[model samples]
Every structure is written in structure tokens, then in C-alpha cells.
Target: MEEKNMFCFQCEQTAGCTGCTGNTGVCGKKADTAQLQDELTGALIGLARAVDDTSAVSKKTWQTIIEGLFTTITNVSFDNAAIEDMIQKVRAEKDSLVGDCNKCQSPCGRTDEYDMQQLWNADEDIRSLKSLILFGIRGMAAYAYHAYVLNFEDPEVNQFFCEALFRIGYAESMDELLQTVLKVGEINLKCMALLDKANTQTYGTPEPTDVTLTVEKGPFIVVTGHDLKDLQLLLEQTNGKGINIYTHGEMLPAHAYPLLKKFPHLKGNFGTAWQNQQKEFDHIPAPILYTTNCLMPPKSSYIDRVFTTEVVAFPGTVHIDEQKDFTPVIEKALELGGYKEDQTFTGINGGTQVTTGFGHSAILSHADTVIEAVKSGAIRHFFLVAGCDGAKPGRNYYTEFVKQTPSDSIVLTLACGKFRFNDLNLGEIGGLPRLMDMGQCNDAYGAIQVAIALADAFGCSVNELPLSFVLSWYEQKAVCILLTLLHLGIKNIRLGPSLPAFLSPNILNFLVENYGIAPITTPEEDIKVLLKQ
Candidate 1:
């Protein structure tokens, strides 16, 4: 048998402008790890078909399916051990539904593990639709996982995972697969909503919080990714241990949550975007904990001190297992001891602090003021300039785009992408900050809520409410969010640092024609076009 290398095109940085058709992925995923991820995805699909066949989807089975798909997402898990472990869980779930294949009298192919290569080599249109369903579910699973961590699980959302994954492998016709594609978007809205509720109900509705870029002296730990529960656990473990906790990447918005910020030792943020971690973390004294995806392969300089928990694991890094004790992370943080003197850091723009926590409730609390300003012409438009940030060069377009927004416009942002311009100080209008950081990308739910409230207050459709979405995407989370926006009939959206390579020309054209989706151009030209509209 010919040796298998790897085949993955899940994110924005695939090779050859389409798929990772070589030994390694653009994200630095090794060939063996990539193939293992494919196997995991295949196993999850098989598990889904099994769950559907039996109609007995246990909570454990549901979680296995969700986390398995999420693990296969780009930059999520690079550990062959972790991927193989998850594959076993998925395979075990299938076995639980139906006994060993060899022991069964009739071997039905309904629940057989479909080789991922089949979908990869299918007709272009069918492959595109199936990829959308698979990738979209993978993204939504991240939100569901966060919610699950907080003990919130929606049966509808969980069931959809099985339904969508089942369709990915078994659904044949283009028309059949199209429903699954849209359903991924429709279901993701619920997933994000569940996460928003989980976060607010558990952590308290996020408030307007101004977080500094300064990292105090002494022992400290940098927590990154989107899992609040992991951050909370680390905070609890390190509370009296003399270790300061600082949020990084998507975890930055954790400071705005009342429950998270209550710990006095939970200090300010560290580093910039996830893509910048390699350079930023070089020679750093603190151990960083990755709670979720968007993890680049750790560089050797700091890999020894890097800790991963939940589904995030990178080879030699210490991984906090099911107990989630985080003692290893704590020990490493204390071992580093941090800088001798207090060090104050600034954002890429040289701003010492950035404001966050303008979640749905916070923004809606100022609805009257916001509406009055718009009525008084003090605020002319609202620009939602946010999404996943990447290492891609042209991503600076987001910074330029936000800088060019009219002074009267209220800019709402969320996710790691906001780092591109979150510190630019766009000033305030109607007593509210002109540029509001509305939590993480999952808080796109919060942005949606705020937009709906604005539209309702003004008695107009969301798209008619002087709001525009100019998003930058690098991963599947953005894909699910974009699909949700489209499902809601929002129009004239701009997405860039280049659209997904997986999007076939026909699919891209369909989106453009139906939803007015377009790739972003120069900020000067695009800003003028959006402002005029």
C-alpha cells in the first residue's frame, strides 16, 4: 500500500490555493497528525451515523462527536496521541450502538466509517457542500463545547451535529447536501446563543471593562483561546499561589466577565494575536495555557513551559487531563517567576490599555442613548469589523478599514481579529465608546442581539439599520458565523483576508448573487462604498 501523507483544506492557509496536497499543512500540521485528524473526522462521521441509526444519542456520545470534529479543525490539536484517543472514543461509541462488525450476522454499511478520501474526491459541487457542512459543524462545536463546559447543552444543537455529520457521509445529491449546508448555519445560531447564555448566566453579563496591557512582576500565567471554564479553573488554582493570570488572544474578553475578573491576581492581557504568539512568547517567563483551537505549533524557545488543557495538546507540552487540576501549569508559572521589575506593554498601536466587555447586555443597556444619537445624526452608521485574525499579510486591511470608518459610526468588534485595531482609540459617541469590544467571536451572538435591538428600536430591518459587516476570517468559526448572517438575510457583507479556498466558484457566486457577499478591497474605496450605502 502507498504511504499516506495528508489531505486537509479546512482553513484559509491551505497550500496550492486549495488543499494541503503535500506532507504538511500551512499551519504547520505534520503529515501524520493531519492523517490522524482525517481518521478522527471519519470516525466521528461513522459515530454519527450510528447514533442516528439507533436513535439513542447519549450525552457522552454527543460530546464525543462534537469534540472530535472540533479537534480536527485547523490548529486545534497537533498531538497524535490526543487525536488517536478521540478516534477511539468515537469508535467505541459506534461499537456501543452496534456490537463488533465481525460478530454481527448482517453487516450493514449504513454506519460504516466512510473514508474521508471519498468526500475529498467526489464531484466538485457535492464536495463543496459536504465540506461546508463538515467545516461548519466543526466551528459550531467550539461554541457548544464552551457552553458544555459551563454545564449548558442544547439538545437541538447536539442532535444537529449528528444529523449534519451523517449527511456529510451519506447524503448523495447536491440538493440533499444543500439542506445540510444551510442547516449548519441555522443550527450554529442556536449554538452561539447557548454559549452567550452560558457565559452571561455563569460569569455575569460582561460589563464595559478597560484592560491594561501591563504585566506586573512576579509569577504569572498567560491563558489563551476561548474556554472560560479553563481560565476559571486556572484562576481558582493559582488564586493564593502568588501567580498572576493574564488573558491572551480570544481569552482577552474574559476580563470583562464579573466572575473572572474578581480574582485580584488575574492581571492584564499578554501578547497580540494567536499568529503573533511565536514571536511574542519568545523568552517569556510565563507558562501559557491553551484552552482551545487556533494554536500554532509551539516554537522550541517556550514550548517547555506551554501547557494545554481540554482538546488542545502539542506533543511535549504538559496537558491537563480530565481532572483539570492545572497544577502543572501553576508550577511552571511559579518556576518562571516572571520579570524582575514591573513591565508595561502596549498594543500594536502603542495604546497602553484597551476596552472590552461591551457584550449584548452592555450595548443594549445603552440602546436609548445609541438610538438617540443616531436620530440626532451624532452617529450615522454602525460597522461590525471583526472575525478571526491570521498571519496572512493583507489582514492589515481590517485595521485600515476601522480607521477609515466615519467619526459618527459606532464600531462593534469581537474575536481575536479585533486586535488588528482594538487599541486605535476611535473615541466615543453618545457617552458610549465608538469602538466597542463585544467579547470573543462567539459573542458574535452579542453583536447580533445588539443589532436586532437597534433595528427593533428604529422599527426597521437589521440590514436597513445603517449597519455593515466587514469581517476577516481565517478559520471555521468565521464560516459558521458568516453562514448564520446569511441565514438571517443580511446583505452586502464583506469578508477577507481572502475567502475560503474550499468555496467552489459556483458556491462563491451563489453567495455573492444571493447575499451580496464580496471580498474586501482597499479600505479607502471600501470604506467610502460602505459609508455611502
Candidate 2:
């Protein structure tokens, strides 16, 4: 038997392994735990395969696939029992598809469970390419799942999700894998657009919302993650009960939307990035709610008060079903009684309030001002300092990166990672705040729109503009966003805390040669290189 250090390192906090190959992750995933996750993924692939044709996809199939994939995300579901239940659902869906296939006697040969190990341990180049495909699809699935919960579903996005999963299960060869990688980007673009539409249409375009870090006294719930619908439901259930709701992590954007912000009891933000949850939620005098991913296992001090809705699940935490009844969570918040007096918390940068909702619509509406500033040399460059945050000490590079950017430049940031510096009062340039918060991770769509609009206004390709991407990636969402940038032919992107463990040298070389993607160095050196460009 091969002796191994706990083989798990797919996250910012990997154990000794570059990509956790052993019986447990450094984060505490047991070997059997890892195997169940793989099995759940395989079952999802089987369900995807069963939907080889469009006719085979039902609402049930899409829900199962999305939930199954979400369950496999790091820290979301660690329970073997939950994973087994999901596997059974996937099998049942596959069975239904087989029944239909048998009646028609049409063997598509498309439905089959993929051995995830094939992608994990393939030839380096093929593994990198396939990893991009699989990870991108997983990230895109999260967005689609959010839209699904709001009763808004996109047929093209849903069908392509299944198609992508099917290919991941069956495709072979580096060339084939490379195509699948780019296709993930293409489909993710549509999926993001669909989500943007769903979010805006449902909640109205996010505006410039200045959310305070001050937690109002009385019972409150701190809701975290990317699900606006879940937050809205909580707000609704807690309304008039004197229980205040606070947004946390990606849910911070919920404070900016008109539909959601209308809740009188929806107070302000709580805590910073997801990684800080263990400390931030310690002995918190409120019931905390997790609506999506980036959930660390709760410490015992606060575990009893944590509530999960949607796809987020941690064993022993209460799970809210589709009805969205948040009574139990509300009851917990009231029981905790919160702080005796209003307590003020600050962002990592010590700013009392962080501003968000400057999405594409908000930014583009001021296009004339931005264009004039550029023409007048008031704005010399645009820097998109965005991506996921990790536990690496080097992540301080971002804070330093934003700090060192030339005063004449504008910084556009998105994702929870931006919480590192978004609260800093970088002030403004030419009537625009130096750093613009462009909503959540999915709001990378907003950043892309702003770029395209700027390109159009200047009558040049987006690449021709003086814009540079300094991204920090920690998960599959970042994977899909990077692929989108590549799909757009955008170049000269600086990525860190580290290049993905899945990116082989050959594939990395391909990206370097074609897209000029490079690992981030020191902020001082990166600023010099970006300014030189």
C-alpha cells in the first residue's frame, strides 16, 4: 500500500498534497469521504449521459445534476449520508432515461458514469484541459442553480450543462479535452448572462449601495454566501419580528438590489470573507445562515446556531427546505438576543462601510464621464483586481497590489475576494470611485460588460485598452471566469495565489504563449510590468 500524507489540497488550505490524493483532506475529509464525493460526481455524470438528447432532460434531471455537483464542492457537503442520498437520486434519474431509451430502442451510447480518476490522473495536458472543462461546468452549475431556485430556468444553459457533463464523462484525447475546455467557457458566458438577466429582472439592477458594518441591536441573523433568493426569504420571514438580517460574504451584494434592499429588517453586512467565518462567527450572538458555498465546518461554539438553505449542508446544521420557511433560524436569532448595544464592525481595511452594486448597468450609465476622463488623461489605466480569496499568506499581494496601483488608474473588483480591500477609501478619480465594487463573483459579468463598453466607446478591442487583469483564484468559479476571459481573447492576465493544480506545464505554456497568463509576482513588480504594457 502506498503511504500518503492526508491527500487533500484542492482548496486554499490543502494538506501536504498538491491535490489531495490520500484518504483525507487536510481540511478533514476522510478517504471514504473523498470516495463518496467521487461516487456522487460519477452518478451525476451518468445522469448527464442519460440526457444525451434534449428530450431526456426533465426538471428533475437538471435539479439532481446541479444539486449533485454542488454537493461535491469543497466544504459544502461533508456527510457521506447526504452524498449517498444524492447518488441514489442520480441513479433513479438515469434509470428513468434508460426506460425511455428502451421504449424507443434508441441506444445513444451517451449515458455512462465517468471515472473521475480519468480526468484527475490523465496525461498532464489532457488532465489540465479536462480539469478546466469539469471545474468551469461546476462553477457554472452554481449560477444556474441560483437561477433555478428563483423559478427562472434557461433551457439552453440547462441543456448545455448536461451536454458538458456528458462530454466530461466520455471524451478522450488532449485535442478533444481542449475543445471541451473552451466550450465550458462559451457555455459559462451564456449561463452568466442568463443569471445576470435573472438577477436584474428579479431584483432590479444593483445600484450604488453603501452598506454599513454596524449591526443593529436586537435579535439578528447573519446570512452568508451568493444566494439572494435565500436571503430574501429570510428577510421575509424575519420581517416585523424585530429580527435584523445581515449579509455576509457573497451575500453582501444583496444589500444593493432594490427588491431585496426594500426589506426594512435587512440591516447591514456582517464579517468579511468566507475564510474568516471560524473566527467571525465564534460566539456570535445571532443565528448565522449559509445560503451557498465556501462553508467551513462550524466550530462547536457556534455550530448549533448555523442554518443552511439551498444546497449548502454541514452535518448536524439545520437545513431549510424549498418552502423557505426560516422560522427555526429566526427563533434561534431571537434566542441569542444579539449584542446589548449596536456594535460596529469594519472590513479588513477598517472602513466603516463598503460600497457595492456598481454593476455594468450602473457603470456604463456613466460611460460618457469615463470616456472623457480617458480622453483627457484623467484616467491612465484600468486594473481589474479580482478573484477568489484563499488562506495563503501571499494573498496579501492583493492588498499591496491595489495599494500600489497608480493614482491615475481605476480599479474594478468583483467576488468575495475583493473584501480584502473593497472597504478601503481609495477615493475617486474623475468623479468615479477609484475602486468600483461590481457585485459578487458572478458579477464578473458586470466587469466584462464594463470592459466591452469601454472598448466600444474608444473604438478598439478590449485588449487594446489599457486594462490588466490581476486575478486570485481559489475554486471552480474562478476557473470558469478565467476561461471566459480566455474565450474573449483577453490577454496579459496575472493569476495567483497559485496556478491551478490541474494546469499541466504544457497547458500552462499554451496559456502563457497565447494569452500571456502568468503567476502574480510582487505588487511592485506587477505594477511595473502592467504599467509598461
Candidate 3:
């Protein structure tokens, strides 16, 4: 590795709104931290190559791949030692697969390793296309890992992950790279479908739920991230303990699940998005548990009270290991005593209550009503205001975009970014709430289902339908979701607060020319363009 200052501009809030080409990221990642992440990525590529054509992939191989990929996500794992250990595990798994292949003589050519630098420095267009395949797959992998932990695994989805990784390591042409990019969308569709099945099967299909903003008085714990299993586990452990659990960030959707909401103590949502955690958690008298990423480093005031479980980690915070013993978090919540009196908090829009659980099943069931509303002009336009949240100031565009949308328009949002405006009460149009929260980031799967259903009902393609996607992206998971949208040939998406640093101009041009991708301008201008289209 070159011992120069580090440079990374893959997210929306890059340093100085350009790129973080310095000793640390604008988000606080250090130089050594960036290199270790690179090393881990390199090792993961190697592991993928090692399994290139193997007849069988063991549980250990899949586990190593999932953990390794998760570790490279923006703020998940920062410890060099942990990443190094993961790299060793990848190498060991590769060696075992290699040894098995040596005896067969008929090399399956299935497993092999990749060096990610080729992607970092490829021709601009090829790099952009490949980056889409690579980063998009990375985001999709997080959802797959989450679903897998809940005992739901799709073989085709898993196999495509390995295949995509293998191509990223060796693919050499624009056409090949472009094909890989679409394949990512195809595979992610299955991955998202698998997660949907897992979530619905494990925790019944979500019904329309009215979640309150008031957190009951008592010992309470706030759980964040998109892992339903962690939420279920915490709910199980905290049951009957006089502790109320509140969903935060991506955990907001847990409220809609019948199995999860059955717990009376499982109360409503706490804060807004993950980016607001530091300010939101300050002086809060409860333990905050992070089941997954988008965790910013905690301040000392709430640092001791913050606990991480599963793959999420921060150096000084306490971690709840595999045993799922949340006793420490529970003890901390009790010690904090919470609020002596019941407290009422309002959402961003001053709405006392927000509704969720309008997933694919629920939305599709109402397709006829929705189609009629559009035909009758009760619903003028549909806007999908969704994607990741970041520290960029321009992100306020989402809030303004939703705020300025016509009352006749419906705003459908997904992911943590929606927290910015999910609290806003846009009122209703034609009996449907003007704004709908479609679960966590993975619930983009649900949003896609709603889009396709609407398209079918209206006898038009998804793009020809009166729907516009105005998205805000911050991490790799968003990358995958965007790729999926592109794969389906959906066009005219306005993305912001900033575009990914990984996309070269040529690749961006391809997206612009082919998919009509554009950076978000002013909310006023974007709304006008969207309405005109």
C-alpha cells in the first residue's frame, strides 16, 4: 500500500463536499482504517475467485464472504485487527477450496480472488459500470446477510453474489461490465424478494399500522438498523422486564409486523435518521442498541450507554455477542431510570402519529383504488422520495421536495433518509395518506412491487406511469437499490445530495444517456421537471 494520505469519495458527504483525500474521512475514518478496508476488499475478491467453479460451497465459505463484505461497508467495522482476522479467514477458506480442486483435476474455475484496484483505476466508463456492479452488489449483500441470519437463504441469490464478485475481479470490456451491472439488478431483485419472504414468513406480512410518537414512561431501550432478527431477539429478552423498546432508524418498520408489535412494551419510534443519533441520544436516559451499521461514533455522554451486537462495532462501546445476551444494555437502561413522567415527542412535520406497513402486499391489495384515484385525478403524481441519509446540507432538498409536493401527489419513501420528512403530515389524497413510509432500506423491495403493480394496473410501463424517483444516497446499500432500479429500465431519477465519487464521467454519462440519471437540482426545479414529465 502506498503510504500517502488516503482518498475516498464514495459517499454523499465527502470532505469539503468533494472527496476525502486526507488522513481521515469527513465522517472520521482514519488513514489506516481506509487501508484495512481496502485490504479486506482485496481479500474478499480473492475468496470469491477461490470458489469460482467449485462444485460445493461450505457454510464457512458463505459465512466468511458475508462477514468480509459487511466489514467493508462505510462505518461498520473500523478495527484493523478484526479486518485482518477476517482476511485470514478468507485466505484459509480459499486454500481449502484450492486443495479440494487440486485433487479433482477438472478445475471448475468457480472460485478465485480479485484485486479491487483494477476497478479503482479502470477506464472511466468501464470503472463506473463495474463500480455499479461491485458497490451495488455490496449493498445487496448486506440485506442477504440480514435475511440469512433469520434463517432465510436463496441459493440463486448467493450464487450470483459469488459470480458478481468474480467478474469484478476479472471482467475486461464495457459490454461485459455493463452486462454485469444489469445482472446485479437481476440478482438483487431476487435477494430483496428473498428478504421479503424471510421477513413476511418469519414475522407475518406487515399490516397498515399507526405508530405513535409518544414513548411510554419506564425503562426503555432504542434499537436501530435493518435487522429484524436482532429486534426479535431483543424483544424476546426484554419481555416482561418492565422495559419498553422503541424502534429507531431502519427499525421503524418493526412496528408494522404483527408478531413484533404484539409486545405491548414494543413502543413507537424514537429519533429520526442514523445521522442524527449523536444529537438524539444526548442525555437520553436509555440504552441504545445498534444491530447494524450507519452508526456514527458516539460521544462520551451516550457512549457508555451505546451497545453493539452482531457485526456492528465501535472501539470503546460495549458489544453484545452471539449469545444475544442484552443484559448489559438492559441493565444500563434500568440504571438510567428513563423519564419520570410520560413524554410526548412530535415528528419533523409535527404529526403526533405516522403510519407504516404499506408494503407490497398491502399496497398491491389497494391497487384498484390507487389506479382509480390516478384516473380520476385525485392522485396527480406519485413521488418515490427514498434513499440513504448523509451529513450534506443539500440533503434538506428531500424535506423541501416533500413539503412542496402538491396535495394531490402521494409521497412514498423508504430507507433511513425518509426520517427527514416521514414526520411531516402531508395529509391524504383520495383516502390514502399523502406520505407513506415503506419500511427499511430493503423495503425498497416493497416500493418496487408497488411501482410494478401500479404500472400493470394503468396499462403502462413503470417509467411511463406518473411516478418520479427523487433519491438521496449515502452508502453501498443505496448503490445496490439504484442499480436495481436501473436494471428494470426505470428512468428520469433525480439523485442527490451528491453523486458517488466512484462513478467516472464516462460511466455517469452512460447512466445519464441510457437511464436519465441526474443529480438533484433545487426542489422547486426538480418538482417542476417531475410534474412536467
Query: What's the lDDT for all of these models?
Result: 0.88, 0.83, 0.84
Which regions in candidate 1 have their CA more than 4 angstroms from the true location?
100-102
Query: Which candidate leads the pack in TM-score?
Result: 1
Q: Model 1 clash pairs?
A: none
Evaluated against the true structure, the overall lDDT of model 2 is 0.83
Top candidate on lDDT is: 1
Total backbone clashes of candidate 3, pairs 3 or more residues apart or in separate chains = 15
lDDT of 3: 0.84
Q: Candidate 3 deviates by what RMSD?
A: 2.5
What is the lDDT for 189 in model 2?
86
Error of 2 at 408 (Å): 0.9
Q: Give the alpha carbon lDDT tens digit for every residue of 182-203 in model 2.
A: 8778878888888899999999
The C-alpha RMSD of each candidate to the native structure, in angstroms, is 1.2, 2.5, 2.5
**lDDT over C-alpha atoms for residue 76 of model 2:** 77
